[model samples]
Target chain A: MKLLLRLKFLGTDFCGWQYQPNARTVQGTLTAAAREVFGTDCRITGCSRTDSGVHANDFAATLELPFADCPIPCARIPAAFAMRLPPDVSVTAASPVADDFHPRYTVLTKEYVYQILVSPVPDPFLYGRVWHYPKKLLPDAAARMNAVAAELVGRQDFASFMAAGSKITDTVRTVSDCRVQREGDLIILTIAADGFLYNMVRIIAGTLLLAGAGKLDRVGMRRIIDAKDRAAAGATAPPEGLYLNRVTYHE
Target chain B: MKLLLRLKFLGTDFCGWQYQPNARTVQGTLTAAAREVFGTDCRITGCSRTDSGVHANDFAATLELPFADCPIPCARIPAAFAMRLPPDVSVTAASPVADDFHPRYTVLTKEYVYQILVSPVPDPFLYGRVWHYPKKLLPDAAARMNAVAAELVGRQDFASFMAAGSKITDTVRTVSDCRVQREGDLIILTIAADGFLYNMVRIIAGTLLLAGAGKLDRVGMRRIIDAKDRAAAGATAPPEGLYLNRVTYHE
Candidate 1:
């Protein structure tokens, strides 16, 4: 049997989802709990491998396993898993999935949100979870920065936006939708992408934010993207502001 | 000049607001930071002292200083002080206040909120910030609790609803307002009073929650309060759910 789980986490305390040799990873924790609950070990696949300090409201993962007796309750799994998992990582929702349903390959859309905590005095409660920028940026200015990011929508070569790593040979991806809006003191950057590269979402956020702060122009960002060189991009944004808000796998 | 500031804090990481002999209290942190900013020793009087693992969204405090200074930017005082403060504490606003004013005495009201995370599964990110209850309580229970707590409004003998060591010899207290409202997945128990004794509010919350869960009837709670015995009250709720949500100071 295969299982799919919807999860949320304040990723600051974990070293990302995928299993590592010795580090405490979200995948490792989840896999261990799953093995305990299911009474068997299985292969668990995640939709995205988020960086440390990055948050997620809806992260989807699938695990293929064989259990002894019966189906575990969806709500019960998160409770049981949470008891064994650390404080920062949690299995929020879980359910049995079809054998053919992949957590990533069959995803319909992926939504990511980046938060900008624009305030003179930093929010102490939000210190580790939000990116605090003391300088005030006009709402229109932020919209303009997001406009630069909007230009990169649709299928395009994202070589310039990719971080300094040749981990993936494919650098092309499509941004289905992108928008930047302000909710109170929070500048919310929501981007829906058919696919994303290594640090692609964060880099795009950084580039547009520079334009928003009047440090870079829209034309400059376009030129950098056209340059197709990793050096041509702006600095990568901090992982704290990034959130893998949702992962939509087709029904 | 005397400085009055509004602060917000997630108190889970610190001892209570007052400075303890060896523990890290919020007041100790503030005093340390104030010394660095004002370049002299100072006293900070918080309108309310929250316990460990408690949280505060609105609070007022006085930073006593002879800031008739020759140099540093006064407008940036809070930001500067914030840098030295811990991640859980924040100065939301700072302004010069009358030298004679006292935060505790001037406070008109204080509102404490208890957030019960009513769900089978606990939220990892909200650990230590919310109290999770595995059983799902019936809706409208909050309304019933609110109605029951209304009987305790005005001045009344709150001895039975207070902790064992409530030192304020007079057990009479006025509850301006008492509300139990369910917001999202949380059950918010808010109580406003002129003041409270140590653990008094927590004891009240625990008793009220018992009424909300149908464990205690209104008549039984009234009898308990009239009995004037601390043991008649329900157990003190965990500190995690309680928050010093607001403090109102007089002009």
Candidate 2:
């Protein structure tokens, strides 16, 4: 019996969310916890392989645990696993999913938020969680960027905004939503898509940031998108500022 | 001439806030940054020797620099220092105070907060920042804790709540305000006082936690306060959840 669990984590101390061999990964930790609790690690998979230093408010993973004749105290599993886990890792919830249910192959969109701290002083409290770009972004940059993002809301070739040598053949992912908002010292970049290519988000965010920072104007943005070449886009933004905000799935 | 600067830091990456004879302390980091910018080994002094894993929002500190011959770029000292310093430590503000202004002695009041996360599953993002007390608190614990905190307000002999083995002759400190508020799943305990003895805030927070958890009754709180004995108090809370929120100076 496999269980699909929703999770949230701070990925600073992790080597991203994947199960690297002999590495301290979020999935590896979860695997170990599951092994300890259920006494096996046959089936476990993550919804996404978040890059190093990335954060997540809602990440998911599937694990196979025999609910039939569970010998251990199943109710105390979360608390028990929590005791053995470090402060940086936490299990939000666990539930039994259909045997065919998959965390990654689910039919829905993923929402990510790229945080930028635009202020004279870097927020000490939000150091790692946000990109400390204290240099004031250009006025009307948010609106202009939103307009550019609107162009990407539908299915389109996102090859220009993806890292080179991406094995994924399809660059026609539908960007369901792309909105930018400013709150005090923060510039939040919310992007939703059916799927993402390698470094697609970081690259797209970089292009948008260039526009927001006034380095690349709206014309440049249009040129980059139409070029359909990875080299035409701006530098890839840092991974620390990116967050896996949520992953939606239908029943 | 010297320049005194008040600051704050997340102590997770630091050994502690004070400078040790041979250690990577917050003071050491600040002093190094100050030297890198001011070109002088400024003797930085912190208000408290915050324990390892402790956090401070407005940790008071004084930086002794040769302000007389300060470089033309000295006005950009905070930004320069921040760049040289690590992400966890920040020079929030820089101002020239009196030469005799000692961060520890000249401070009039300090406010601190201890957070508790009462939920079934821990929040991975708030792991290093908040204490996870997944145990269900008493139903009316919030209101009950507030009422008890109000009683402890004003000038009172806080000997009972203060941690043991202190040499301070006076244990009477005016607790201006102590509040318990819940925002989402996190519970924050905020306290302000003219001065605090060793582990005073932690001990008080621990006892209040007891009240919130229903481990100790309201009468027990008064008894502990009136007892005026350190042994009468609950366990001292962990350092991770405690934050030196701010420091106030006397006229």
Candidate 3:
């Protein structure tokens, strides 16, 4: 039976979602646990290819078992996999799905959040969980960031926001929402899109950081987007601050 | 010059706040960093002795340097210490204080928050940060817990809440406030007290957990407190779920 699995992981120690021969990866770890739980080599596929040090609050994946009648119930799959999985990765939920369902090509939006700790001193509790910006942010930083972020909404060619050296030609993607807000010392950038280019969210976050620091304005951001060149955009923010917050699927 | 330092730490990898001869400890690590930064054996005293695997969001300490003519300014002390301290512990703020100021005895109240993840599956992002309660919590668990917690307010004999092997005789303490609230999948218990007995908060949290589960009620909680016996209370909750959230000192 094909099963849809919802999971979350702290990506600090992982190389990424894709499996590598030597380095540790979330896909590799989950796949091994699935094998141990099912007593067979089941094919495990993830919904997104997250970068190293990126986190996920709600990630989606699919598992295809060789046999239809497995001993463990769909509800018990998470518990079965938990016994063999590491503490850094977990299967939160599991449900049976149609054989034609694809984890990656499914219709819906993906939401990502970037966390920035705007403080002079680092916080141990948030050491690897957020990007620590030592400089004092402007009092109206969130407002300025939101102004720049609003320009990112809707379908557009996001080539400028994509990571440099990307080979993919199609950079047009539909951004449903983009917002910036501050909660105490942390500035959060939340964005949702139908599809994302490589490093798109991180680059946008970096650009927003610049906007918050009074380096760029909404017009400047629009100009960068129109430039359609990777070099025109801001630097790609670090992966540690990024979290795949949500994934929605069409019924 | 004497200094008061406010700090935070992820206590998972440490023995605790106190200095240990061989084991890794927050005090020992901070002292070593102080020696490197100040070029002297500065005495460091913490406000509380946290247990292993516990965490602190706001902790207080007093530093007494043997010599008062040190070069580093008070504002830059945190920055200087940051260079030498490990990533797991951080000195967030440092300020000049009276020579006899005590971090512990002079405190007015300390606030702690205990977190419980009410879910069937363990969350990887919250590993070692919260107590993963696998059973289903009642829909009104927070309200039930709060009802029991409200009985803990005011000065009272809290011997039942203290650790079993504690030798401290004076178990009477003033609890300024106690509350329970739920945020999404996490149930949080926030307690503020003038002083806390060893494992007092953990035991209270455990008792509230029972109350939330319908195993105990407000009357049961009061009976346990009135009994003034450690055996009468619920088991002590794990240290990982308890965080030293705020430390307030008398002006």
Worst ten in a row by lDDT for model 1 chain A: A66-75
Top candidate when judged by lDDT against the true structure: 3
| Candidate 3 pairs with clashing backbones | none
Model 3 docking grade = medium
Ranking by TM-score: 3, 1, 2
My TM-score estimates for the predictions, one after another, are 0.93, 0.93, 0.95
Model 3 per-residue lDDT tens digits across residues B151-235: 9999999999999888999999999999999999999999999999999999999989998898888889889999999999998
Worst 10 residues of 2 chain B by lDDT: B66-75
The docking category that best describes candidate 1 is medium
Angstrom error of the Cα, residue A16, model 3: value is 0.6
Model 3 / residue B240 / CA error / Å: 0.3
Q: Write the per-residue lDDT of candidate 1 for residues B1-251, one digit (tens) a residue.
A: 67788888888888888899899888898888878877788778888777888888887898776656424565777688677877788888778788889998887889888888877777766788887777756677778777777777787878887677656788787789887887877888888988886787778877877876888777987888889898988888889888887888787
Candidate 1: the clashing residue pairs are: none
Number of backbone collisions per candidate: 0, 0, 0
How far in Å is the alpha carbon of A126 misplaced in model 1? 1.1
Best candidate, DockQ:
3
* Candidate 2 ranges with C-alpha deviation above 4 Å: A66-76, A119-124, A139-144, A217-219, B67-69, B72-75
What's the DockQ of model 2?
0.60
Once all C-alphas are superposed, what RMSD does model 1 give against the true structure? 2.3
By TM-score, the best candidate is 3
